[model samples]
Target: MKILNPAMRIIFLLSVLAFGIQACTNNAKEETSLKMLQNKVDSLNLFVQKMKPGLGELMTNIQLHHEKLWFAGTGLNWKLADFEIGEIKETVDQAKEIETDRPETKSLTMLSEPINAINHDIENQDINQFKKDYGILTQTCNTCHTANHFEFNVITIPSAPTVSDQDFKTLQVR
Candidate 1:
């Protein structure tokens, strides 16, 4: 008969625990990467909204994730319906249902859906109407916030940071 002694069993359990820990670590890393991409999206939107300019470099950075995020957002190579729209609706609906200190405005969610639509357009290389779409999304953010009593906390399109160190430019090999 095969048997695992206490010491062997403990070692085996520890190995499983180690693997669990590694998986959690990996998830955290991936989450951070996703947030970085979102932040860049926010930053670029701000720049565009304010007419601050400098999109070439920012776009180059956005392009770096062309495959990783911009495309994989759908979790598929090609699709008719915009996948990011589904994400926007899901997130906004969930956010609205949650009981927070303030009622849910879905300002950020509203604000980003149009932007994501633009991103979808960009990914398809259909550059004709992205800017108009983005403007509408930015307006949605402000309008939602004001209507929901979060006027004091109106979230604008994020711009070049005075505090954050995350770079949006595509990485360079040095």
Candidate 2:
């Protein structure tokens, strides 16, 4: 093998050293970028954990909506009843999504039938059927609670409107 001249050897060594330095610099940059990305992901996870509502809070919202739904149906306000049912369904869906770890969430499926029944009654504008279906919905709620060992939290047909500011009756327009 032909021996490399001293100057050639120096140039070759310098080239290898330069390439090694560049590779190390790129590796360090990649590691820094990865750490920053991981930190961003951790921050988002923490924010979500803080913002997530508890199962009890979600159930309380459902209870309020349930009371409103009763008044709406009893007052023959089909539109309002429909809206209240929709809100209940939305809240139930949110509970299912956010409280996946809770066993009670699994029982939420039992509500779907009663909710759909009430919706059908509302669509038909059948006040009698709506009242009957509303009882069913309330009973279903109590059933779920009882099954979940929350029997003390009994749900019943509301005797009076909880909110005084809002009217359950449909507005009559001239």
Candidate 3:
């Protein structure tokens, strides 16, 4: 067995040293790439975190969406006051406009045309007339939902509330 010459040993040592340096360089590059990627992800997360909407802004978004749904198109559901025949938009419109403290917007809308008609025919003392119109409005809401493929979302006319819409019955009657 002959010993390696000093020159060959030195070359072998230098080759091993070069490979060790290359491995360290590759590891450093991989770490740098991983840190850049992590930083980009953190930057995106911070941007999203800063972009959150305020409560009022969120509420406005929801309200506008609903308004679009109920008021956007010129469908039969938007016109005919008879909830039974079609159109519950009148109810929503009336409720949106009422200035009363009681938020009977649903009730006011549910009883809108019927209340007007009842007031007109008040002297008749026709319970049947009011009842019939009430049923019509209520049934119209249900029917509209059904026709629009939302049959599961049933809307019934709320029962008479303890809270009356009329504070002044005589004036209200007038």
**The candidate that achieves the highest TM-score relative to the unseen native structure:** 2
What are the lDDT scores of the predictions, listed in order? 0.51, 0.91, 0.47
Candidate with the larger TM-score of 1 and 3: 3
Candidate ranking under lDDT, highest first, comes to 2, 1, 3
Count of clashes, each model: 0, 0, 2
Off by over 4 Å in 2: 1-4, 172-174
- Cα lDDT tens digits for candidate 3, 1-174: 148788989888899999999999999999999999999999997886567554334324423332222211112122211232223333344335542333433343444564456333333434456456545645755664566565886655443323344231223233
Q: Global lDDT for candidate 1? A: 0.51
Backbone collision tally, model 3: 2
Best lDDT among the predictions, by candidate number:
2
Model 1 CA RMSD to the hidden true structure, in angstroms: 19.4
**lDDT per residue as tens, model 1, 1-174:** 149988899999999999999999999999999999999999997775566323233323322333233323222332322443445445454444442333453343554667567667656745345445645654675586578665774444333333234333222311
Q: What TM-score, to 2 decimals, does candidate 2 have?
A: 0.91
Q: What is the C-alpha RMSD of each candidate to the true structure, in Å?
A: 19.4, 2.1, 15.8
